[model samples]
Target: MISSEYCRLMARYSTWQNTSLVNAADGLTNSDRWKDRGAFFQSIAATLNHIYWADALMLERLKGNGRPEETIKHSLASPSNWDDFKVLRTQRNEEIEEWAARLVDADLNGTVVWYPGDGSTRMERPTALCAVELFNHESHHRGQVHAMLTAAGAEPEPTDLSLVP
Candidate 1:
């Protein structure tokens, strides 16, 4: 079972890495950031949007909040506005940090029943494993974003977990 302390640490690392990547991405011109390089999302903006949507989706699931109507689209209906995206993403990081702080070892041992994707089906797993998957999902997408950014001629910081300080 994962301890609350471990969850908190994961949250801190996530926050740090996300902020770093965003900052690096910010250095590019809007056109450059939004350029299409033929990736899944096709553009940096779309890819980031995908990451944001995925993170938000997982957060809602982990918190027992209802899913957004749009699911994992390249654009968001709620955070559709660029300004709103920044605000919501920042808020999400804070929410994640808070959730981590509130977790307990017992909470990790408990099971979370969820649908991996759309439809009426359900699955169960240890809560901590789900939580770990939540963070891993973010990191996984961020790596994709980083690769896209680099390929677009914008250098992103190395993302080795061991590099986290």
Candidate 2:
């Protein structure tokens, strides 16, 4: 079981890393940001949108009575929109921060059941484990986005975990 403090820190790190990546992407044109370079999620915006969708779904599963099936039914092909995505992202960031700040030891010890991306089956595990997976999922896709941004000549901020603030 992970401690609430650790979860909060990871949550903060998630926000920092996501914002840094989006900022880097902002340096690119809409076409470039939306371009698919054959990476996961295909483009910077799509990858970020995928992460947002997944995080929202996981958060609902973790903190709400809803199941993944009852949550988002489709992966967004892009961020909400050129303008709306920023707002949605900010809202999600706030929601995640609040959830992390209020997290309790019991919350981490509890379990979350959900369908993985493959949709093969539903699985259950410790809420802390799922929380770790949630953050890790964002990092995994953001790395893809960062690579795309770099290939497009956009310099994403350093990804060092220690730099989160």
Give lDDT tens digits, candidate 1, residues 110-154: 666656546467776677888888788888778778888777677
- Steric collisions counted per model: 0, 0
Per-residue alpha-carbon lDDT of candidate 2 for residues 66-116, written as tens digits (9 for 90 to 100): 456555566444554667887788788888889999988887886677666
Name the top TM-score candidate. 2
Each prediction's RMSD over C-alphas, in Å, is 3.1, 2.5
For each candidate in turn, the TM-score is: 0.82, 0.88
Model 2 pairs whose backbones collide:
none
Q: Which ten residues in a row have the lowest lDDT in candidate 2?
A: 69-78
